[model samples]
Target: MEKLEEQIAHLTRAVDDLSDIVARQEGEIVTLNRRVHMLMQREGEREASSGGAVVLGDEKPPHY
Candidate 1:
């Protein structure tokens, strides 16, 4: 019974540690998602203002 209690305690501690790690990673993911959204919006606006040019190499822009 004591060994069982010890094992349960260790499992609980491990689960709590994993939960904290998941929470921290969730926050980081949210931050990274926001940054990616902002970058995408900026790139879209830049492309629109540039007349929808192709992103591929050697392709002339629509203005050509």
Candidate 2:
């Protein structure tokens, strides 16, 4: 029937749109994951250099 054909066409378009959205989101996730990994690596290096000490602002006198 014509109605059925129209419904099928609409459903097809909707599916295609969703597929595009999913593809774009997947690409963004990959990029973000890479960035996060790089940041974590940098943090690890920094911590290693600092000898794992938690630096709090500038060094102060023990009496202060």
Candidate 3:
């Protein structure tokens, strides 16, 4: 029936729209993951260079 066909067409469009949204999210997730990985690497390097020093006090250093 025509009504059934119309419903099918609407559902198809909705599915396509959702697919596009999912693809965009996948790309964004990949970019965010890469940024997080780079940030972690930089943090690791910083910790290593700093020799993992622990500040005993809540006060800021005099350099601030």
Which of the numbered candidates is closest to the native, going by highest TM-score? 3
- Measured over all alpha carbons after superposition, the RMSD of each candidate to the real structure, in angstroms, is 4.3, 3.9, 4.3
Q: What is the TM-score of each candidate against the true structure?
A: 0.82, 0.82, 0.83
Worst 10 residues of 2 by lDDT: 52-61
After the best TM-score superposition of candidate 2, give how far the Cα of residue 32 lies from its true spot, in angstroms: 0.6
Question: lDDT tens digits, residues 2-63, model 3?
Answer: 99999999999999999999999999999999999999999799878988776456558889
Off by over 4 Å in 2: 55-64
Predicted candidate 1 versus true structure: per-residue lDDT over 1-64, tens digit per residue: 9999999999999999999999999999999999999999998999999897777876878799
Which sections of candidate 1 miss by over 4 Å? 56-64
Name the TM-score of candidate 3.
0.83
